[model samples]
Target: MSALTMPLAVRVIRAEHDALAAMLRTLPLLLAAQRLALVPPDFGALRAMLFYVDEFPERLHHKKESELLFPKLRALVPGLRGTLDDLEMDHAQGERAIRELQHSLLAWEQMGESRRDKFEQQLRVYSTRYLRHMKREETEILPHAVRHFSADDWAELDEAFGGHQDPLAPRAGQAVDEAYAPLRQRILAELPAPFGWGPALGA
Candidate 1:
């Protein structure tokens, strides 16, 4: 069969891979900031990254994988369904991890030392789990799912996220906020770290 006709499950997973790959590189950026203790810490920049964790992959990618992709995989291979269920659990846990990361970032920026220490420890621990989870997916799960997904599904997914408003798209009044006052200036000043600086972090 042609590429587009490949299983929908595979197509969607591949797209998820691409998106995850892009977002994963930001970990180092976060780590850099954590290490440097960059003054006037750009919490906005950090929040923008966290926003993607909640918004893009969680909302779009995981939704498709959990809802659309996994069901069919189970149908084709009965045993596979259990593993897919485990994956769903992983996604669910990821939300809590991101939430914790956000709390730590904000607290650290505000110079709450005890909270910062606690959060940093959690953040590193969570990062390890997240990376390990991704490895499991790429290595153990992707090959089987790929056999079922189609290129058409991948194309459609690509289009949907392509429409996602620019992550850098500030809140409606943000521009005006920057123009009018110092608070706005601080908020606007916290631009996203150079996530685009390196190679295409895609699979």
Candidate 2:
């Protein structure tokens, strides 16, 4: 699509959704690796990944939407109140869910393999909630904004989303969140090759 067609903010938001979806797809592998011991779970890598979930998407992305995008949209289209409220609730719940997952990660790391089932279940729940949340934003909210919001609105949204100064050096031409760089590296280094950054077993 042309630049005139898709607002930069929407593009950025969609990028985040895609990134989170990729991460969520890893959940099964992550949990299975932990449960079956097919490969030893790198609790440190797991923690780092979860920290990215909490810090970047949950905190930065959602905060931008809730604080800036949603409020502006609410004023532009009053009918969006219910959907906006639901989305906001999802954001809040996501924070709590991340905390639960963090706690589970710590417990498993420190105490051995006691709450594996609980951790897996919580991971699945959080993933499902997050996927659903993003789906709503994509299907219901973004299209509405594109339709109802003005050019000025789009400009402001793009500026707000794009203006954040990433605190880390750009890697592969894209800015990586500073805190997540190590986590990204760890995922590459520890996980199996092709899909993972690390070497394959018995290689």
Winner by TM-score: 2
* TM-scores, one per candidate: 0.63, 0.84
Q: Which candidate wins on lDDT?
A: 2
What is the Å distance of residue 75 in model 1 from its true position? 0.9
Q: What would the per-residue lDDT of candidate 2 be over residues 66-181, giving only the tens digit for each residue?
A: 99889988998899899999999988888888998999888878887686667777888888888999999999899888888888888888898776532221323566666556
Tens-digit per-residue lDDT, 1-203, candidate 1: 45576544444455555445544645554455645764444466567666666765667666666765567567766877667778889888877778878877888778755565676577567656666666677666666666654666556545653443323333233242233343323323443334343332231
Q: List the residue pairs that clash in candidate 2.
A: 188-197
Minimum summed lDDT over a 10-residue window in model 2 is located at: 164-173
What TM-score quantifies how close candidate 1 is to the native fold? Answer: 0.63
